[model samples]
Structures are given as structure tokens and as C-alpha cells.
Target: MDVLPDRAARAEFPVGERQLIMKKLIINHDRLKEARDAFARFHFPVVGGVADSGSISLVMGDSRTGKTFGAKSYLGGFPQRPGERGMIYPALLVEMPASGGYRAILENLADAMSIAHTLRMNNSVLTNNILRGLEFHEVELLIFDEVQDVCDIKNPRLASDFKRLMRKILNLEKASIVCIGLPETYGLLSSDKQLVGRGGLQYAFLHPYSWDSDEERKSFRLLCDQFDEGMPFLNKSSLGATATAERLHWVSQGIIGLLKNFLFIAGSLAINDGSIHVDTTHLAQAYDWIKPPQTSFNPFRDDWSKKPDTVVTTAPLTTHDPFAKRKRSAHAQ
Candidate 1:
């Protein structure tokens, strides 16, 4: 496999500044791979033996649990082996804007299809162009990431506009739509009766493994083992060790995003400090860099014999409306 040159490397940066861009991590664990496969196998239903008609499939998870990765994998899986199929685009992924509305969504779709003149056109014209472009490009799956952004807007009509847009796309194009976001995204989709009726499948990525369940703990340990194997330090740190794993779970509060950040910080700190091993001390420094809420409980304290109180309170991942105050004020009058 030929490794592509980093585009960032070509850009001019100060000597020391370039080092910060080089340390990037892409974790390809088994679980993520499985989700990708399942997403790929998803077939649009043939109603009354007619093909090309599809439904919406949603992939939901807490923040940073690989929702985008899974969607990207499915979108990137087209033509299977390279050159087998010529210019076949099986999936198209678009991100919903932070203050999403009908026009913004149409513009995004038009941009993804590489259709110009969309900016000058009206909504009806743009819709036709998008439909034509999707058909021309042979797009079977359409994905909208950060879909919760629509719901986060102060304008209640924005959500309904998105729902209407999605329903129209499904009816006209007969292509399946895959929306990826947090639990709130599911709520947004489920609110629409028409969207839910058309075979809406909810695939949720759960929170980090919990000690409350033996199966979840075992699964988490397996994940830790994979990370341990991948750790580049010369000294092998048994991340899967009972005590170490527990500490990690507590500090990370079972979120994969935090866990990844924790490891990255730990590795960078260890390398900078001239340490060949990544131990509790390195992780403690990593926590400081990460700024997780629990600063008092350092996992790598000198008292190695006892476990520290590192329990973290979990919070919902939804972004609230910025104009919520204005709406409340209006209602008060």
C-alpha cells in the first residue's frame, strides 16, 4: 500500500510547530470494523419487488465514539477493489450546518455533487439539480453527519424543514439516508412520523464499558489490550491489568474519545519527558493536559498500593440552543 504524502507537511510552518501536526492517531479496532461491515451490508428495501427505493438508517452514539469513522468507511467502500468499477459513487456524505436550514442543506447537497449554479437558483430548481446529480452520480446512500445541529437551532421550523427535506429526498431519489449524531439526533428523526414510518433503523454506539456488567468489562479489557499492543513506548505498560484498566475506566468515564485523548497526551508527555515507559505518572500528566473534571484524583499517585477515587459524573452530549434565552423571554411576554 502506497502511503500518501501529508498535505500538511507541504505547508510552511515554523520548525518546532511542524512536530505538533505529525502526531495523529487512527484507531482501527475490531469493533469499529464490525460496525463498518454492518453498515455496508444495509440494503434499501424493495417494496412490492421494486428496487432503488430505500429507507433511512441512523447511527447514533455519544460524542466521539467513531460515528464519523463508521460512516466514512461505508462511503469509502465503493468499487470494493480499486479500478474494478469506474467512477462509481455508492454513498455521499454531507454534514448538516450548525444553524441548519432548508437552503443550507440544499447548498451542501449541491456542493457534494459538484453541481455549480446552485447558489443562484431557487429552492425548487436546486432540488431538481440535486436529484438529477444524485441519479447521475449513482448515489445509493446519502449521509448527513452532525444532524443534531438542525435541532440545536432556535428556529423550530428548521427541524421541520430538515424532516421535510429528508422525506422529499427519500421519496424522489429513493435513496437511503444515514444520519449520524448523538442521542438527540435520534430524537430529532423520531419526531417526524413520516420519516420514522419509512424503515428508520437506529444503530447506537454505547458508552464505555461498565464494570457493572461482566461482558462489558471483558470487552473493554480486550480494547485495552489492543491499545497496549499499539503503544510505541519501549517499556510495555500492561494497560489491561486489572487495577490499571479500572483506573483508566474511571478516569475516562468509559468514553472512547476521552480514552484516545488520554493515551495521546500520555504518549506525548512521556516522549517529551525523556521517558521510554508510559506509566501512571505519564497518565497523570496526561490528565493534567486533558483537563478532565476530576483534578484531585490522580491515578498515578505515589501510593501505588491503593486505588484512587476517580469516579466521573457523565453528562448528556447535546448542544443547547444559543438563542434559548430570547425564546424564553418572548414566551414570558
Candidate 2:
């Protein structure tokens, strides 16, 4: 088996078509900082665990809440101090396939490590090699994203295999596992007895705030101020203004993803219109594009803005499948 590939040959591969590269910016805001702090607290304790037993943690949240980003950020900052074992990676991050068996999982791990592909190897052999590879790399923390794929009830075998594989991987000294997924991941992971050890903790990534809570409202106002201060608008954003903040809260439902998207869309619109201010009109235009369900409490509407106090409070819309049939119908896709 050609486990050691020619690095020069791989480098000869040509680059693909040019992509419409949008600037990828990381906003170091309060919410993301909180998540990172929580991860740090979770990580240190697991490092002291026994060699034979590893800690399993669930980082569950609604989609687009920056769970993956936070996890990656934490792992990216892992200690790289060189020692007798060479460059030590205190953590490593990998993503799960949408659907596949144990073979697919092995392949993904091999791909991550840039190991030469070897399909002829048996499953047990491949698994052993991967374990050795992780040990060789000295990865103490193993992070998996989109882990809800293993929760498919229709294919119990895949889920069962996932648990078995995780148990094996965690056997490494001071090795800890982190899984990031939507809220359903908590329920799915809890249902599996093999996975439900009471030793681990479950953390929600996106914590939505209530409009009525004074502390929450203050925190949101501060967040709005930070975002507004960072934008390049000449007329200075009033997103932190009490009325504007109220309207913004209604529009975003306090979801960080929606709130950030609204700001970006509105800011872009303002830039395109040769204006420096993001007012109600720009926000309204952005809301039209966001096309949140046409509820009675549409804050973007002119009438609603005039009587912002009348905006009815509703539960945060986290469960709505953005890719569902209704979404396609609404978007004319």
C-alpha cells in the first residue's frame, strides 16, 4: 500500500474556476466570546480524565448560530508547542458525512490526515490505522461537526457503529470528543444508551434573549452598538436606539445569525444606494429579502414601525427548516 504519497505530484493539480469570493470576516462579539469561554472551561477538565475513558461533549444549537465557528476557533488555538513527540496538536476538527456507513467515516478520517487512499484495507485494519494516526498526531481533543447525521433512526446500524467508533477513539490518553449539531442532536444522542454517560455536559450555542428582560435588553443594545460602530456607514447607525433596537429584536428574534445577516444585507443595501445610513427603509428592504414568515408582527412594515409597542411577542423561530418544501414555495425556487 502506497501510504506515503508523492507530495510534489499532488501540488501539480491545477486550481479550479475562480470563485465569487465574499470577504470572510470573524466578528469577535460578546456571544461568540461567551461560547469560546464555555469551550475552554469544558476542555481543561477532560484533559485530566483517565487514559482509558474519554469525555464526550455535545455543543448543540440551532443552525447558523456560530456553533461550528466557535468550535473551530477554539480548536484552532490549540497548543502547538513542540516537545519530544514533535508538534503537539491539543485538538483536531473534522466534519461528518451527510450519509454513509463506517467505511465513509474511515475515509473521512483518512482524507483529513491526508493519508493515501487504500480501499483494499479491511474495516478493522483501517480503524486501527486511524487510531494510530491520531495517536501519532497527538490529537487530544477530537471535534466532529454535523454529527446529527449519526442520528438517523432509519439506519440504526450506522448510529450504532458511530457510538462504537467513538468509544474506541476516546480510549486514547486524555482524549476528549466534541460534537456540534442542531438541537435534535441532544435528543438523538440521549436516546442512545451507549452515548448517554452522565459524565459529559451539553451546551447550547445560541442563547436568545427576551425583549422584556432588562439585562437581556441591555446586552442586546450593547451588541447592536458594537455592530453599528463597526459598520462603515457615514451617518452612524442608530441600531442601539431604543426604538430601533426594539424593531431589530423583533426582526431578528435575537438569533445571532439572523441579526448579523440583517445587518450585512441592510448595510450592503445602504452602500448600493449611495447612502451612508442604514435606516428603516434599508432594513425594510433587507427584511423583504430575509422574507421571514408573514406574521402579524412584521416589524419591517411601516405600520408596525410607527406602533412598535404593538408588535406582538412570538416564540423564536428556530425549528423552521429553512430548506423545507414551504421555504422553496415561498422563495419561488
TM-score (all chains, Cα) for each model = 0.78, 0.78
> lDDT: which candidate is best?
2
237-276, model 1: which lDDT tens digit per residue?
7888877776677656565666776776776676567565
- TM-score: model 1 vs. ground truth: 0.78
Tell me the tens digit of each residue's lDDT in model 2 across 69-178.
Answer: 78877866775567586556667678888756778888887666555558789888888887887777677777788888765677788888888888788666456787
Per-candidate RMSD, Å: 8.1, 9.8
Task: For residue 279, give model 1's deviation from the true position in Å.
Answer: 1.5
Cα misplacement distance, residue 325 of candidate 2 (Å): 8.9
Clashes of each: 0, 0
After TM-score superposition, the amount by which residue 55's alpha carbon in candidate 1 deviates from its true location, in angstroms, is 0.3
Native-referenced Cα lDDT, model 2: 0.66
Error of 1 at 324 (Å): 16
